[model samples]
Target: MTEVFSSNSELVLQRSVDINLSDSGSRHEDIRELYQISETCAFITSNNYKKVALQFPDELLVDCVAVSAALEKETNAKTYILGDTTYGSCCVDEVAAEHVGADCIVHYGRSCLSPSRRLPLMYVFGKRPINVQECAAAFRELYPDQESHVIILYDVTYSHAIDDLQRLLGDTYPNVVFSVLRADHSHGHACEPFKVRTNSDCQDDTFVHKFGRRFTLTNFMMTWNRCSFCSFNPDTSTGRAESININKALMKRYYAIERAKDASVVGILVGTLGVANYLNIIEQLKESIRKVGKKSYMFAMGKINVPKLANFLEIDVYVLVACPENSLLDSGEFYRPVVTPFEMETACNKHREWSGEYITDFQDLLPGGSSHVDFTESDHSTNDDTTDVSLITGALRSSCLRSSPEPTDGSSSSSSVVVRNQTLTMANTNAAASFLSGRSWQGLERKLGEAPVVKAVEGKRGIAIAYEEEGTERKDSACPDHKNLNYRKQSGV
Candidate 1:
C-alpha cells in the first residue's frame, strides 16, 4: 500500500510484518500504507550509480537526487553521495533541501549521458558561503573592541606572512596597535617586551638582546587582534642593576674571606644572568687577591655567556651551568658546581667574611705609608701551647659532630665545606648529612690528616675564629671563642 501527497505536506511510513503470509487481507493493508508513503516521498535505489534505475511512479526521487548532487558540485566544487542508501532510504536529504526551498536539480552523473561535461550546479548545497559570511559578520559585531592591541604570535612557518599582515592592518587602521612575534619551537614567543613597547616608550634592552635578530615588524596599526597583547612594560634594567649591586656586595664579602685565609684559590660561582655585573667585582678583587699571592677562580652557571666573558678575561675555567633539575660535573675539568642563585649568594658572603683578616692586612699595606710589622715573630712563641690546644680541641669537636647522610642517587652533593683558622668551623656538615649517615669526622682519619689547625683573632669588628693550614687561614665570625693555631702548623701563607 502507498500514498502520495504535496511536497509541502509531511509523510510518515510504518510497516507491520505477519507470520502468516497466507493472510491476504492484512498483507493488502500493509502494502496500501507503504504505497501511500512512497507516493509522496519517492523511493530511489540507495546505491549511487543505481539511484536512477529504481524510481517511484511519480519519478520525483530521480529529479531530487540529481538536483542535490549538481548543487554540491557547482557551489562547493565537491561531490556528495545521494539516493535511498545515502539518505537512509527515506529521501531525507532531498526533503531537507526542499524544505529550504532550493530549486534546480542538475543530475551530473551517468543520467546526463556526457559524464565528462561538468556544469555549474547551484542550489541548496551552495548556501554554505552565504552562511559563513553571516557568521563572520556576527563575530565582528560581538568583538568590536578586540582591535585595541593586535599581536600576531605565529610559528616560524607563518613568520613570512607576519610582515604582510602587519602592513595590511596598518594601512587599514592607523590608530590600532599592531605587532608580530615569530615563536621559536617552544611555542611561547617572548612577547613581554612587545606588550610594553606597544603601550609606552621605554625600550627593553634585555628583550632586545634575547630576540632582536629574530624579531620582525611592519607598519604599525591599531585595529587588528591577531595576537596576544598586554599593556605592561617589560623593561628589566632596574632589576638587572639591582642584581649587579647584590653581586658586588657578595664579591666584597668573598674577598675578605680569601684575604683572611691567604688562600690562593678563590672559587666564585656566578649565576648566568648575574655574570656581567659580577665580572667587574671579580676583576677588582682579582688584583687584591694577587697582591696577597692568591689566585681567583670564577665559575659561571645558568643561561650566561661564559665563553665570551672568559675570552675577554683570559680565564681558563668557563663552565656552562646546567639546568638545576639535572646537573653533574662530568669530569671536573672545569668548576661545574651545581649551585642555585641563593646558594651562590650565601657562599659568596661566607667566603668573604671567612678571609677578612688577610683583607685587612692587605689594606694596611696600601700607599698610606705604614711600617711593615711581622706579626708571626714575637707573638708565635708566647701562645704556642695554648694555640696548639685550641687547634686540637676545635678539630676534635668538628670531627665528633655528626650529620645524617642524604640518599646517594648519583646526584651532585649539596654540601659545602666550612673552616675557620684555629676554630671548629662547620663545613660541609649539612652537605655531608645529605649524603651519608652514622658518620663522624673521628672515623675519617684520612680527613683528619688533611684538616688544618683553627685560629681565633681580635679585629676591629670583633673576635672571630679562623682555620689555619700550612700557608693559609680561614676565619668564621660565628665561632669567635675558638683559639688561634700556632703559626708553624696553621699558616695559609
Candidate 2:
C-alpha cells in the first residue's frame, strides 16, 4: 500500500507501532498482511453496497485512509471516515453511520460482533503475525504433565496464524485438539475463520458434525452445545480434569453477581453504541430496575476507566452493555462492582435462578431463538401492578418543616437548617434500618410513625454540640445570646 497521507493527517499517538508507508503503492508485507485486500474486495463485491462507512478504532487510524482509498478504487464506492466511537470500539458505531447515510459499515480492528439492528457491518480483524513454531515449542516444554491432547488457545487477533501453529504442533502432538467458531451469517460481520482461540481443523464433513451441532454463545453448556470446540470431554476421565478451569471461571462470575445484591444505585454503562439492538436491552434493564425499585442511570462514554466513573459517587454498581469481548474489563480492579447485562439480570431479577450458565453475549440473555429479549404477550399487555410505595411517605422530618428558623446571621440560620436536615436523615436512616429489620419489615415502625429522632444540641460557643430531642421550644428562640453576639461577629459565623 502507498503512503497516502493528505495534508491534514491524524498525528501518530504511539511511537512503538508504525505502518511502513510504501512509495509506489504496489503494497509491502506490513500493510498488505494487516489489511487483507483479497478478502475485503470479495466482501465488498458480493455485498453490492455503494456508500461504505469505514470505522477504525483509535490505534488503527494511521492506516485508515490508505485502506479506505484502496476499497473505494476497487469497489467504485464512495467512502466516509468515522472517528471516535461514543462507546467501546469493539461495538459497531451505528450512531455515527446515520450522519453520512452509510449503506454498510466496514469495521476495522477489535470487534465483539454484536448483532446489528439497522445497517450491516463487516469486521476486518487486522492480521498480527505470531511465531507459531516458537509458541508450540514453548507449549511442549511448559506443560509435560498433561496428555498429548492440548487445547491450543489464543486471543482472536493472532487467530489468522492458527493453521501455521497446528502444522508445527502436528509433528510432536499427534492429537492436537482445535476449536472452530462458525459465523452467524444473519449479520454482516460474517468475515470467515473468526477463531476466538479455535478454528476448524478443516478435516471433513464427518469431523465437523461429530464434533458439533450449532456453534452458539447462548446456553454455553447445553447438551447440544458440544465440547466440540475442544475434543476433551468433561464427562469422561480426561474431561473431568480439564473441567476444573471452566468451573473456577463460572464461580468467579457467580460471586460477582452475588456481591451486586447489596448495591443501592446501578449505573448502566452503555458500552456499545454501534451494536445493533441496544434499545431493547436497555428497556428490559429499566423495567428490571423498576421491578426491584433501584435507581438506574445510563452513561455513554468513549473510553471507560476508573477515573471516568469515579466522579459519580452515588452509583453503587455499574453494568457494562458493551460487546462480549471488550466487556472483559476486570471486576477485580474497579472500585465498585462492574458486571455484564446477563450478570445484572442475575443480580436484580428475583425469579432468574442461576444454573451455572455463563453467557457474555447480551443477546443470549433473551428468551427463545431470537438475538434479543422477547417479552411475552402478557409482559407487553399487563400493567405493572406493584407500585413501589416508599415506606416513609409523608416527610423526612419529625416536626413540620419551616421556611426559615428566624434568620440570624445567614450561616447560623443555614447551619441550623443543615443540622435539622441531618437529624431527619438520621431518622430516615434509622427508619430504613427498621424497614428492612424484620420479616414483615416490622410494619410496627411504619404504623407507629417516626421514632425518637436525634436533634442537634445548641452550644454556647466553640463547645461540643450534642444531639437531644428535649427543650425544643426553648431552642426555637432565634434571638442571639448577647454575650455570643460579639463572639459571633468576631468569629465571622
Candidate 3:
C-alpha cells in the first residue's frame, strides 16, 4: 500500500513478555508462590466448584497454562484461562466467566479490589520483589519527622513485602500505618473488610477516617479533613526516588468540578460493566443532573479514547463511571473535561460539602459507603440561587432557578426553570432540549408522511481521495483547468 493508505493498515497482534523464566526447581516453586496456587486450590476444593475461570492479563498469559494445570491437579476442577478482558483487567471479567458457567473466578495479577456482585472471586496478586530495608530508608528520608502522620499504600505486587515494611518501621514511626490486602472472598461480602482501616479504641480526636485509610494531622485549623496524597517516583538520573505531589492533581480535579457545574450537557461514560452497582450509579447520576437543572447522556463505548468521545460534540463535560484505578482519566487529551462520580456529586448535590478528600471509587458515593455524605432528595427542592465567577472561563456563573407561573388550580409545576447566560430567557429545565434548539444542525428532520420515500442507489465508486471516473480519466483531460499545467503533467496531481 502507498503512504496515503498506510493510516488504514492494522498492526499484527503479538503477546510480549518482560519476565524471564528458566527450567529450575526454585523457579517452579516461585511460580506456585507467585500465583498463589496452594491457597487457590484450597479455596476451590472447599467451595466444591466444578468449573472455575482463571483470569490473566496479556503480560501474564505465558504461565496461564501451567497455573491452570496445577489448580486442576489439586482441586479436581476444570479450569479456563481468560485473557484480553472486555474492559480494564483490574475488575473481574464476570461476563466472560458467566459464558463458561464458571462456579467462581480466580483473578490473577493486579486488581482494583472492587466487589463482584454476580460471581464469587479470588485474587492472586503475582508477587514482585521489593527491598524492605530500602523502602524503610526511603520512608525515613522523605518523612524526617518521626511523628509525621503517614499511611503507606502500595501496589498489589508489593503486598507481600508490606508486612516486612511495617515491622521495620513500626517502632520508629508509631504514626506510620501500612495497608493490607484481603485475598479470600468465597463468602458474598468480598469488599466489606477492605473499606476502611481505623482504630476504634484510639481516643484521639485529631485522626480522621476516609478513603479507606485512617491518619491524623498535627494542625486541624487549615480546612475540613484536608489531606495531601503523595506517591514515590523513581529518579533515574540520581538512582534515587522522590515523592510526587498530588496536591496539583487534586486542584485540577477541583477545576474539573467547576467546569462540570458550568456545563449545560453532561455525558456519563460507562467505562465498566463488571463493576458492582455501576448501573445504579449511572441512574443516580442522571437523576442528580436533572435535579441540578442540567442534562445527562449515558454512553457505553468500551475502552474510551479521544476520537470516540470527540464525536459527541454537544457534551460539555463527562463523568466516567469506571474502576478506581481507571476512574481518573487524563482529560488533557480530550476535548472536554472528565470528572469522577465524587466530583459529579459535589457539583450537583447542593447538600454535599467539599472537604478536599478525593474519592476514585464510585461505590464510596453510594449509600452505606464510607464517603456517602449526608444528603436527601428533598434538599434539591429548596432554591439556593447563587452566582460566582468561573475559574475556567472567567465568566459569571449563575444558578438562578425559578418555577413557571401557578396554574388556575393554585398548584405549582415541579419542573424547575434555570437561566442561561447567553439567552437570558426562561428556558425549560431540560438542558439537552435547550442545547439542541441552539445548534445549527438538529439531526434528520422528521417530516414523516409529507416527504416521499426514495430508493437507495450507488454513488461513489472509489475512495474519497480518487473517485472511479476521476481515476480512469485521461492524464491530459485531468489537468484541463489546472493553474500549473506542467506540474500536473509531471506528478499527475
Winner on TM-score (1 vs 2) = 2
Weakest 10 consecutive residues of candidate 1 by summed lDDT: 108-117
Error at 131, model 2, angstroms:
1.9
Q: Per-residue CA lDDT of candidate 3, range 31-82, in tens? A: 7878878888888888889999889876677788888888988888999989
* C-alpha-based local distance difference test score of model 1: 0.28
Misplaced by over 4 Å in model 3 are 1-29, 140-149, 182-247, 374-493
Summed over model 1, clashes come to 60
In Å, residue 198's CA in model 2 sits off its true spot by 11
lDDT of 3: 0.68
RMSD, one per candidate, in order:
34.8, 18.3, 10.0
Model 3 poorest 10 in a row by lDDT? 212-221
**Predicted candidate 2 versus true structure: per-residue lDDT over 1-493, tens digit per residue:** 1132232233534345433332112343555557776677777788888788888776677677888877877887788888677776666787788789888888876555566777876777766444555555555554443344444444345557768767876676655565554665676755433343434423221111111111222223321222423322111212111232545567777767765555557888887775655666776776575445465778876678766676665677888887766664566656677888877887666466777645666765655433334322343223333322222232231111122235554564322124446346322232223335544533434323334444445445321232233332233345433223112221112
Where does candidate 2 have its weakest 10-residue lDDT segment?
A: 205-214
Q: Point to the candidate with the largest lDDT.
A: 3
Return the TM-score for candidate 2, rounded to 2 decimals: 0.55
Candidate 2 residue-wise lDDT at 299: 88
TM-score of each: 0.19, 0.55, 0.70
In angstroms, how far off is 162's CA in candidate 2? 2.0
lDDT per residue (tens digit) for residues 1-493 in model 1: 1122222223224442233232222233342232222321222212122222121112233243444443333333222333332211211223323332323122211110111111112111100001223322332333345443333332222233334444544554443443443223221111111232364532221111111111121101111212222221122111111012333443443433222232224444443221112344344344333333333456543233223343222222222222221111222222222222222222222222222121111112223424122212232232122211122124311101112235466543333543445667766323223323543432434445456666745432322332343334545577655554433343432
**Model 2, residue 311: C-alpha shift (Å):** 4.7
